[model samples]
Target: MSQPLTAVSLSGVTKDFGRVRAVRGVDLELQQGEVVAFLGPNGAGKTTTIDMILGLSKPTSGEVRVLGIEPRAAIARGLVAAVMQTGGLLKDLTVRETVEYTRSLFVDTKPTDEVLATAGITEIADRKVAKCSGGEQQRLRFAMALLSDPALLLLDEPTTGMDVEGRRAFWQSIRQDAKKGRTVLFATHYLEEADQYADRIVLVSHGTIVADGTGSQIKSLASGRVVRVTWENADTEAITRLGGVDDVEVRGDQVYIHAKDSDTVAKYLLTQTSARDLEITAKGLEDAFLSLTGTTDSTDSTHSTEGAQS
Candidate 1:
């Protein structure tokens, strides 16, 4: 058979746990060698979606295919590998020992030493897993995932426990793997990471996809720009009444204005108020995400969609 043009295909997929609907009808298609970021706030069904994609959990309805085959069949062929966000580590083994043991699970495996080096953990090869820092352990997990050299790699919030430096180093290693023409999909809350690394992004909110596009395309979904004016006599309500303003927030001595046109907001602020420290900037992905989802990390609610999508 000819090679499938798609690396992953999900059609009308949904998942439920008892009474809770964790995923809605999520239809997505990813091509080979594409690096995609699956982004959402906590409890947005990101993990549930990944679980179904990995065949760890069955979908309640519809179908999921990886590499043009069912998820389980594709995984059984050693065509898929994942670096999960948590668990699946042997704490008692040293890094080298763990790599060796994990490699034994598959016939087509990379050398233990080579995998460790690729993951940037060669220097800590002898360190006990339990004693390693969170970042080191995460790298070890990544090394294990690479042992099979799978064509598709799935990473779920891969840098959750790392410091900023650790996150950067980890992405550098991942960047190399992605450059090798492997199809990779990673879930993350860090919008900047998605902006920097992913050629495409799929954003979920309330267990359903809200947006899917490249960084700039997603950002463009939000109209206009932002203008911030700092002054002691700013009127937050008056600014909200301006023709260009979409929303306004007031600080002690400043007002932040979200508007379709930054020029209009800035002009009004200058003409009407004695504002200083005026700045104008385009809307970022974070702003777009908030505007699209109608919520933020703080406002994430307990409500779940009921019996989503037949």
Candidate 2:
């Protein structure tokens, strides 16, 4: 059998703007038909990397290929499409008209009705774009993107203004499309969505790829448990001095302790300190994100300016 094609590939990719380096030397690859989540905090070069892949911006160094060809070439052939967070909509047109207008820009296109239904916006096709809610408008954008029947779909914060039901429906459409051999790459602030939806998660921090794995595997990288207890007299400094403790936070009477040896911390909290109602749980994706990205630290100046253009 022939080898599966690579949908997107970045080798030694780096991007810089003046005095600041936005993206460090990064390498990534996504196989065809994979649903991958590209995750990072603000100024992490996630958007910059996406721009390079779309051929909207050139990398200061390295190569970006889409479908084994140049990014722009693949895009020009209607093999790749992107649904951005905002803009590209005409308020004066109805949803159907918006899609039809977009279709006109292409040499060949999927049926407008089919795209609308696939995007779950067929029922609102007659609604005026200006009158549509944010979620509805985003669905209209999805419909517009699907008009090309793209093999690789890049979604940048695709569900930003959507409600709970709207997000659910939107992802359902993406899942169905991915099942049909369409590759989907999305960036979102909602970590739960990535945990639930993505086949794999790629985490970038300070313009570099830090963690790449399944949600569970990423969580394991945190390597600790969080112990929560109600202790009015908890001393943060004292807790930090503990052998296994990594960090501690006190919120009102609730004290949260992150520790590698959770058993020892729990025992000490129950027997030594006035801490009560102790609960110990494994670190979650949020914990891993904060730990791996150094989001809680104020030391990295790179993030402060790297995403200025993002």
Candidate 3:
């Protein structure tokens, strides 16, 4: 039998928990070998939608298909696997023992050494799970997920507790795996990870998808650039009143202005004001995320988890 061209599909899918409608009319698709990022603010239904795709919960309406079949059916066939933020580990077991134990549950599985190497945890194979760092444990989970050699991998906040170097190393492994034609859908609060790693980014807001495209394309939707200047006596109200200016922020002697016409703002700052050290730059993924999601504080506690929806 031939594999399906579409790795995952969701059409008008909605999930309701009593009075709460978590996911609302979501329509999405992922092609084989595509690395896609699923991003949204807290309580935006990202994790709820992921649960439906994993067959842990059924949708209240519409459909979700994995590898052109029901999600459970795809999982049963060993075509799908997930690496969640935490859990599913035995603290007493060594890293190698954990993978070996998981492999026993599958009829056919990747070799323990191969999976450990692929997840970048071969050196820690003999280390007990409880002794592993947060990043090392995540790698162990990745190795276990690969035991089935799944074609589609779903990761939810995979780097939640890792340090800078750990996050970098983890993503390096992910990039290498992507080259082998695996489809990956990851939900994360780390905007830079989505910007740097994902081939495409899907933004969800208030239970609906607000933007879907490549990182550059998504950034373009925010519709403005930012101009920064240094002036001891900065007039924030005056900058906000400037033509084409969307927002103004003042901190100490620095003023940051978001404007549709950055050139106009830059010229005004240089000529009309005592502003110095002027700079203009395009809006980045984080800018787009805030603009599209109506979120003022990107680092809100809501980012810790998807709240009630998760």
Candidate 4:
């Protein structure tokens, strides 16, 4: 078969507000059936970029295409939908009303009852929008976004005010929706959310795409292991002297060792010291983000890696 169609594409894309540049030469391609996490720190131009993708803002230069068409045309055909971070709901409307109004805008739409159920808003369907909590409002927006039954969904901080259980349920709904061959691209501050849920991660900083890959591959960018142990006195000096030990920190009775070869460090602790509660874990996405964004000054530049397994 020919190569799969591109669901979204960006090439040499840049955006500026007055004299302040918000996006810088960002390039990305999103294929169908992929769940991607667009990640960055505050003011990294994530919202601005999303605006361009949704045809809400014009790019200063370069191209953006959704399903082989400009975003406006694609959106008008019910090919795209977005659940933004805030400010879309009408305070006077009820959850059911909100969904119904949105459905009226689309020629073809999912049923409001189905949207309410899937979005977990059935219990509050008749409640006025202004009385709903932030998390509840989020679900209402989610219900509205689903009305179009779009091929792609864009979620910006989609779980901001949810409790732990609510967040879990929300993501579960997203997972089930993705089984239908729909694409999802979400921007979130919760790195662990990206780690566990996303099939691919795109890291941006300074208004540029810095890293794009699976969670495992991105974490591999900051290669190392953490050896955490509870010990009497910690033998801080001896652990620091061990081979492959890059750094050491001690808190109370516990010691955290950063090691390039954790096996060597683990061996020493097992045999030499009264080390207890030892745990070794590979560095995660947070470390990788810090490393790529200049904390550890990782050498990897803007790059994309496929075929990464969990």
Candidate 5:
């Protein structure tokens, strides 16, 4: 089967700040009704790319389109709704009042009760925004965004302050929105969140897309099974004798071998007289992300202005 036409497309997009190139030659496509998670370390230009797509920042070079027209044009039609990291609703207004106010801006809005329920904030709908907890406030923000019934949802860390259950509830609501053919582009620090909710994952590093595909597809890039073995001696000679193991590291009394096949490699290790205890493990998404991004926590760079409301 053929892939569907994309809802948003970015081609050869580049953005710069003075002498620094924030985002460099970035390209991305988000399909209609598809949920894609945008991931990157702090300075990876994930926010810059999203800003370009949202038309908050103009790209120094390249093309960006959302819902067929330009992103700004889409926003003008009320087809796109964005829930930023901060400040989308009135701080003084009650949760219900905020929803009602945002609803007034859109011709077609979801019912306040329904939106509150969808965001798992029904109980606090009457509470003042200033009095709400961080998670409650996040839910209220989402409720306000969904009030417009947008064709595309851009959520920047939607569940940042949510607990486990709240995050699950928020994702359930997102899935329901996707079921109705809405496109969702979310940025999250939680790997498991992307693995569970996103149909495709996009990894960004140094302002460019380094990896993009399904979770399992990206994980496949590592292409190695993990073998755990307990050796009598943490010696190089014993480690070298294990065939088919590519990356070998010894920790205390145990050794980890990364190989093509864990079972086969485990059997080989068992053949050694010193290999009394051995275990095999599979590569996980975290390992894949670290391998692909290779980003240490030092290069954090992103600045958001609380200047406008989308």
Candidate 6:
């Protein structure tokens, strides 16, 4: 297959706030029409990297480019739009007015009504931004971002504070945009959203990228195998005897075995008398994430397994 078109590229990028280093030696690439979910904990340098890419903050080192042009230049040409954490909408302005006002800034703007409808906010088009709840205000901002028909959309925690129905609505709209060859760089703390929306994922921790790949790829870093231990009268010693079992923890009657081949181990446990009632399952992405960033030392490579088993 032909190489994917590059929408955004950052090489050896670094950003510093005074004496503190926020983003260090970061290198990232976003492809045309691709959706990349940027994942990290609070203060993990996610926002800092996004700010640099958006030209809101200058990088301390290295180069950053968007759409073959600097992000600042892209913004000038109305090729990039951002949905920041604060929404940034005039509280008193109505939704239609907000979209219309932003549309005026761009020479080629999506029609106000069309933008409202695309964002699922047409019913509330005439409502003042201040009157809308947090989720509605966010949807309004999303409508404004699309008003310019930007090629690259930068979203920081876009679905935050939205109800389940609202989030589903927002993503449905975003998926339509992706189908049109628009690139999206989304920053979110919600891993499930990343798994669902992102074609690829970049995991950051402590001012550096710890992992970058598809959800399965990242999960494979720590091995994508869960050890589900079920027992009738599961004793701690009996649970530990299962071969290939790594970390074993018990809660109530269930024993959680973090292992490589849980299926084989569960069968092995079944042979033992203590494991008369036994069940074992596989691991998931959540385990990989917790084992990596959630551990005491974020850089530990103890659990770094190569490719995932699918």
TM-score per candidate:
0.79, 0.83, 0.78, 0.76, 0.78, 0.77
Q: Write the per-residue lDDT of candidate 1 for residues 1-310, one digit (tens) a residue.
A: 9874688889999887776767879999988888899988777788788888899889999899998888898887787899976678888899999999878877798788788888899999998899998778887888888889887899988778788887787777667767776789999888998988888999988778999999999998887887887878667777778786788877888677889978877887788788888998887788898887667543333243221310
The C-alpha local distance difference test score for the whole of candidate 4 amounts to: 0.83
lDDT of 4 by residue, 1-310 (tens): 9886798999999987665677888999998878899987666667778888999988999999998899999999988999877788999998899889889888998788998988888999999999998878887887788888888999988878788997888788788777887889999767898888999999887678889999888888678999999987777888888787878988888889989999999989998889988999887778778757653542222211100100
TM-score order of candidates, top first: 2, 1, 3, 5, 6, 4
Measured by C-alpha RMSD in angstroms, how accurate is candidate 4?
A: 7.4
Off by over 4 Å in 4: 225-283, 295-310
Worst 10 residues of 1 by lDDT: 301-310
- Regions of model 3 farther than 4 Å from truth: 1-4, 120-127, 163-165, 226-259, 262-282, 297-306
Point out the higher-scoring one by TM-score: 1 or 4: 1
Residue ranges of candidate 6 with Cα displaced over 4 Å: 1-5, 224-282, 294-310
Across 11-61, the per-residue lDDT of candidate 2 in tens digits comes to 999988876788899999998888999988877888889999999999999
Q: Write the per-residue lDDT of candidate 5 for residues 138-252, one digit (tens) a residue.
A: 7677777777788889989878867788678778878988988899999876788888889999988777788899989988876687778787575556555666566787888
lDDT of 3 by residue, 218-293 (tens): 9888979988888888888878887989888888898889999998888888898899999888877788898998
Model 6 lDDT per residue over 1-310, tens place: 9676588999999876656667778999888888999988766777778888888878899998988888899898888999976848888888888888888888888777788887889999899988998778877777788878889999988887878997887788788888898999999888899999899999987777889999989888878355555565666675567666577777876777777767766666767545545554555777677776664554422122100100
Cα lDDT, model 2, residue 204: 89
Best by lDDT: 2
Q: What is the lDDT of residue 242 in candidate 6?
A: 61
Q: CA RMSD for every model?
A: 4.9, 3.8, 4.5, 7.4, 4.7, 7.1
Model 4 worst lDDT run, 10 consecutive residues: 301-310
In candidate 4 the C-alpha lDDT for residue 190 amounts to: 75
lDDT of each: 0.82, 0.87, 0.86, 0.83, 0.78, 0.78
Shift in Å, residue 197, candidate 2: 1.0
TM-score of 6: 0.77
